[model samples]
Target: MSAARWQRLVDDLAAAGVESSVLDKPYTESVYGCVHHGVSRSITMLHPVSGIISISDRQWSKNPDVWVGWQVFREGRDSIVIRTWPITKKRSDVVAHVLEAFNTEDRT
Candidate 1:
């Protein structure tokens, strides 16, 4: 059973000129269903310093349900998820936030 929101997210990514290769799924540990030990979707994009940036979903309970958000993917490292906030917006807004975070550098 596919979800419309997921598909919409994918569509938004593509329409935003994000490569189709990275819009749907990319090589990630959790994409293999590690978080929930069940099926999940993820999109990975190449980052300058971090190497790869992944946008995935939440899979613990459902209260703070988030459709998609950014994750930190370091090459040759296990994995480090940045954080997820309340995400529920239009395709453009979602894509903008993702791209903005991807381009933001933390100097701390």
Candidate 2:
């Protein structure tokens, strides 16, 4: 399932003319008392330049729901986080978020 989702994400990005590549290994993220897994090497063109975006898997912790979300970092600068709920949102939503971020960065 993850592989299919990853492929779809890559394909969607390609359709949007965004250059990106996914790593084979799962990336580990420790945040808010929970360990989240994501795709490694998800380098994206956050701007005309380049950036890194992580597609995080939903993690459940007693504290709160720190689930699937996006963390976009541009050229090693501060990250722009876009959080989504339920982790069941359509893949198109992710693509739209990426496109929106891309457009926003393009304007700056």
How high is the CA lDDT of each candidate model?
0.53, 0.55
Residues 1-108 of candidate 1: C-alpha lDDT, one tens digit per residue: 325666777787788766534343333344335543334566667665654555566543453343334333323223444543344445576677666656655332
Which candidate gets the maximum TM-score versus the true structure?
A: 2
**Per-residue C-alpha lDDT of model 2 across residues 29-67, encoded as one tens digit per residue:** 787688977554343453555443445444455543443
Backbone clash tally (model 2): 0
| Candidate 2 minimal-lDDT segment of 10 residues | 76-85
Which pairs clash in model 1?
none
TM-score of each: 0.51, 0.53
Model 2 alpha-carbon miss at residue 63, Å: 12
Model 1 misplacement above 4 A? 1-4, 20-38, 59-85, 106-108
